[model samples]
Target: MRRQKKTILLASPRGFCAGVERAIEIVERALQKFGPPVYVRHEIVHNKFVVNELAKKGAIFVDELDEVPKGATVIFSAHGVSKSIKEQAKIQNMFAIDATCPLVTKVHNEASRHHRKGRHTLLIGHAGHPEVEGTMGQVPEGTMTLIETLSDARNFNPPISDGLAFATQTTLSVDDTSEIISILQHRFPEITGPSGEDICYATTNRQNAVKKLAAKTEYFIIVGADNSSNSKRLVEVALKFGAKNAVLIPDANSLKLNELRNVSVVSISSGASVPDILIDEVLKKLDQEFDISIKIESSIKEDVYFNLPPILRTR
Candidate 1:
């Protein structure tokens, strides 16, 4: 039998964006500084591998402040949290550490500013997402209205003020967000928004890189956990950009050998929180199934870094 060869194209600037790195570090450092049983209100990031590792190291995940005992330390997820959550933590006397990504924090700040100015806050994000919940939680109840689609933007009506401002989840489809934003602007000409939109640099850059690769690749794979928003977006972008098929694989074990039966070129990118090791394992899996050649599809180089909180910051 003549051996068939396959080619793998790895996307640069994929995985471990600054925000995810910071959130994970916060959890680890909390474990180091405060000892075991440190409570994190949600998955520090949406990657199961990362969460499982932290769990092994003494981090406890809970859905609410009530689960954490009074005076115990609790860290917020990178998605940010609502104001009511803060008040609840204060009332319980639990020590609070915020692990919200600074980019997400920018949206929170924008929402707060809009609230203070009496403008009804319109949040552009999916419902029930931790980031949306956290951002909306930053203000009084009913202050920020969630708009997930262009229809939602068109139909939204707020009481007390037509004065409107908007923010968005950091991980979202750039093309889709633009449509939603346009609908809001068209419906309410005076609505204000943050400069350059609320989607973070990492999300935008990764999606852009995938789009660049999808045009020429026969198949595309995104390395990310199922619950990860940015990882899901990468798959969507690949399909939209002309790849024959785009699939998300959590790790090497999840990759299906049979699917690559005759695939010629594959483009691979990882979610911002995913580790490179996961990608390497997937490559090995591919190699085991067929004679494989590797190529690096280079794009933007990212070096952004975020500082830890005062508690973890070195003097």
Candidate 2:
């Protein structure tokens, strides 16, 4: 009797979005240019493996700006930063490098534009997320409100005009965000919006690929840290798309054999911050545990590259 082969479908445009790439490059270049003890305001990106690797190279991660010594080089996380954070950096006389994703910075600029135009803004994103916090901080505390659900949109009242505009976190659920945006538009028909979708192309492509592959896959696995919103979204999208079992394990060590007990087809993807090396590790473990075959189901090809900051431009 021949054993049945388990098929694994790999999603393309899965790991390391453009923003994450830029953020990581910023840190690496800073290390090369300035040498060791370079301070980072937050995890440059959320993946544990990336953070640990950078830490090994003397990149110091701190939650607060005060932790950074005067004159030390501090790099902001890809999620952007609050106005107060930039002010504090200046006050402390620290040399700062912003690694905030360009897409996120666009939303921040939109928030400021809306506030300047005397229009109250509704920020659609998860609360307490660094991106959300940083975007909301673009304006005064009372100038904008955070809306996480349709209910928030339903009850939200703008202090200024009904002709409101909105922005979102670069990493968010494409489907869920659309529904929330619909609710906002239904409530305020005069609401203004940006010409382009707020979520980055990499995030959308990954989720779409997961959604397409999950239906045919018995089990779905996402390689990313627990703190990664985009990584978590991939798991949720997979589950929603009909995968019997879906999980987000940081790496191979976190995978459980039981999850694959009856699973004959597996789909895999990684978050924006996650590195391909982690995915490769998981693949190696899967190869040892099961008779697996590989398939590539790519939704789109990604060729986006963000330029390094001016300081590292020559490098």
Best by lDDT: 1
Name every residue pair that clashes in candidate 2.
none
Give TM-scores for every candidate, taking all chains together and pairing residue i with residue i: 0.96, 0.97
User: Residues 85-134, candidate 1, lDDT per residue (tens digit)?
Assistant: 98899999999999999999988888889989998888888887889888
| Sliding window of 10 residues with minimal summed lDDT for model 1 | 153-162
- List, residue by residue over 1-315, the lDDT tens digit for candidate 2: 444468999998799999998999899999999999999988999988888899999899999998999988999999999899999999999999999999889898999999888888888899988999999889998888888987888888778755588888888999999988988888888888876459989889999999998878888999888889999999999999998888999999999976686778988999989888998999998888788899888889999988888999875
Q: Candidate 2 overall Cα lDDT vs. reference?
A: 0.89
The TM-score measured for candidate 2 stands at 0.97
Best by TM-score: 2
Which segments of candidate 1 are over 4 A away from where they belong? 158-161
